[model samples]
Target: QPTLRKLVGGSSAPQLPDDSVRQLLVEADATNELFKYCEGQGYSLFVAAQPCSYTTQVVAGMIYTVSMSTEPDPGTYYEIKIFKPLPHLEQKARVTEIRMAQR
Candidate 1:
């Protein structure tokens, strides 16, 4: 199990940072989850995007918290939370929460 040594608190902590910060390790599954979430929420004009600056935690499965931007628009980012069950469970990823960042 991976333990968090220190947490970069707040939504702003995960924004695109310089070389010092780790880039979000985005997976296709997570991106797919975002697409599904946007569509389900009736976002008719949504753009396809790969969320950046993210973190994950392990519970019964994995929880992904990501920062996303659409259409290259600054301050138009959203903080999304997703839950992915362990592979052995063979469950689909689920979007748990969505918060618009105050960038």
Candidate 2:
């Protein structure tokens, strides 16, 4: 998977679209919050075992970058992150939301 940097082009493309960039950041923030919440609840967020590679998928014309982390010991938590750009609202706009499954 290519990092956003490469996809959006380098610093040379200074004029990167504002909306999409904003949405991508939003998704990152949401993912952070979700991880924090799980940790606070004393649950280990288990992504997946390596050589683990996160599968990035696009749905509804929006790009989704996903990865997993796992801590095996007592409690286990599953995290699914979805990043969707609201291109319809404004071209190059994205927002990320996350759903968690725990056992």
Candidate 3:
């Protein structure tokens, strides 16, 4: 999987650090912080991303997922696991489910 830094818009692939502080790792940490804040406020966080084929078997299919959660504190990490469907899974089916959930 590409590091979260790249997923969040880093310019280049991650590389070894010159010092103890790994910038890419720090960036990822910041992203998680932001997500936590959004979730805490009851925001519906949506991620519509084109994940690379390295992790996702399908190269072209875009992934969409909604997440919301409560946290214990700054250190506690919670995730909304959007299940990656099989290649045979229909995108329309997922969309329908999401729409129905909102109704």
Question: Which prediction has more favorable lDDT, 1 or 2?
Answer: 1
* Model 3 bad stretches (over 4 Å): 1-28, 48-103
Question: How does model 2 fare in lDDT?
Answer: 0.44
* lDDT for each residue of candidate 3 in 1-103, tens digit (9 for 90 to 100): 8555334422233233232222222323433544555567675546522111111112234332222223323332232222234457653212211110111
Model 2 regions more than 4 Å off: 1-27, 44-52, 63-65, 70-77, 86-103
lDDT of each: 0.60, 0.44, 0.31
Pitting candidate 2 against candidate 3, the one with the higher TM-score is 2
Write the residue-wise lDDT of candidate 1 on 55-92 in tens digits: 66767877667777765677667667777788899766
Alpha carbon lDDT at 3, candidate 1: 79
TM-score: which is higher, 1 or 3?
A: 1
Cα lDDT tens digits, model 2, 1-98, are 85655444212222323454435545456446656766877866556321112334445554443333355533443344455555665544333444
List the lowest-lDDT window of 10 residues for candidate 1.
Answer: 19-28
Residue 21, model 1: lDDT of 21
